[model samples]
Target: MQAPSMWRHTLTFFPQFLAALKERAESDSTVTVIGASDGRLVVPLVAAGYRVIAIERDPIALHGGEVQLPGDRTGHAMGLIDRLKREGFYDRVQVVEDDFLETGPATTRCDAVWTSCSWHYSANHHQPLSEFVNRMQRLVRPGGLFGAEFMMPITQRHHMLEHYTSPERLRQYFIGDWDVLLTLRTNEFSEQAHVGQLQDHTHRMGLLLAARASTPS
Candidate 1:
């Protein structure tokens, strides 16, 4: 499935996460996406035959709305719900419109959980970074995968907070009952403008992929 135009060229470790999912999960395995903005990753998971539990709080992203483009252009974004319907993957997804931290765990355990550049947002800074990571980890069942790609510290404000973290720092959270499969970090790199940020920006990012240990036989 094609991602929305605005999200098409973004940098994400989702491909790596997908590879882990394929190796570890069944075709019908349920994957939960925290901060599932506009189904960028959700649609593809559903298209690949996985059931998706999409948790997103933004109404504009989940339901569609006008957006400001890079060239002072105005565009109407096709929200996640509509995109799923258009692609005929709605039935494979359960969209939850709520603040992920405010909600409890899924009624059933998920085969995997993922979030991309989510915790760095100012809106999420009120909570400790550990809280966000811990919450996401809780949703994954034993033997399930947990993946996250996040912003690394680049500014004074970022340095002051634990939210803008590094791969090494994040690994501390996965020390027990989890296997740190892969960890990668990038130097500051330029990124093209997208819906929210209208100008080119530079960022340093990190990715972490871990698998929960299975229950003892």
Candidate 2:
């Protein structure tokens, strides 16, 4: 597929993901947008009236352990929250400046959990696949939804193998513990982009949606 069509198909996954989420969440339900970069899903969830947890490594990435100066920043002071306030959803969202995987399961379970193209950071850092998958199972209450988009490697260069995850490997993480609801994959595209250019290669991205089963007596 050409890059443009691939991009269009790639963008469509979010709404499909959200629609699936709607079937599982109420307007007032609590939603957790893990790795909330630039408030993409966070703002929308808050605007739609679900309280959201906008978690990230920090409100903004720092330089050499120091905060970036105002002029050097590409985003706002409070990251997602700052954007939320401007959009009038400030009071509905909370920001957590910590690693999502390291933060582990939330103390308070939410109605739904979401992430867009962010889980690989934790994987590359050596977080076990089951830990994140099981953590999602724990963070979303029974009957709640968990959704995420991740780029899975069909093949990788020898040096790049350490940081890639395969689709098969990901499925093994959820096999028996949960009920899979939706599984979708997009055409492979050069996984890298630079200044409006795509390299001559590609990788497959898969979407996984599942529900936490109710506890049996």
Candidate 3:
């Protein structure tokens, strides 16, 4: 598939996926944010009256008002937020262009948190995940929602990229702390092969949705 074609597929499917997640949340006044939101796919959630915050590291992609290859991307988080506002989704969102690790602690206090396809890129996944969970616990006020989609590693003959956690690893990462509500795996193929091949294969991708563990009084 062409680059544009692949992007089209992403744009089409991402919104629907987010909608399904929203249905599962089932909350009228959930304050939500997207961590490392590349294409601003969750803008619809804002339009639906949810408070949204977006954080991204790439300035070009964040501010360009158009999605491009991560390498070719430019702009800041506020730029994207401004673009979204111009597009009529500003009422519910704020965008910050900075390292997510730095922002996790301060901004983690929201009713819901959604990290889509970006957790794998964290410099310190463990610390950030823990902090994120803790922040959700504090911000969500119990019975709120947290959702994430991550790339998973799979041992297969033909795969796409690298740097994904295996199923077992992911399980171990969240088991003791979070009560898992859903675990799903799927396969994705890239239109352009060999563009970047740092991994063995790409057969396994994971989605996890769970609420923060209620604090013990």
- Measured by lDDT, the strongest candidate is 1
lDDT of 2 by residue, 75-155 (tens): 223345555656887788787778777774467989888877665553435675566666666788877888887766665
lDDT of 3: 0.53
The TM-score of predicted model 3 comes to 0.65
Whole-structure CA lDDT of model 1? 0.90
Q: Give lDDT tens digits, candidate 3, residues 92-183.
A: 56676777666645634666676666655545464545554455344554556666666665545213333365344455545444666666
**Model 2, C-alpha of 133: deviation from truth (Å):** 1.9
Q: Rate the local accuracy (lDDT) of all candidates.
A: 0.90, 0.64, 0.53
In the range 141-208, model 1's lDDT, one tens digit per residue, is 99999999999999898899888999999988997799999998899999999888899998999999
List the lowest-lDDT window of 10 residues for candidate 1: 1-10
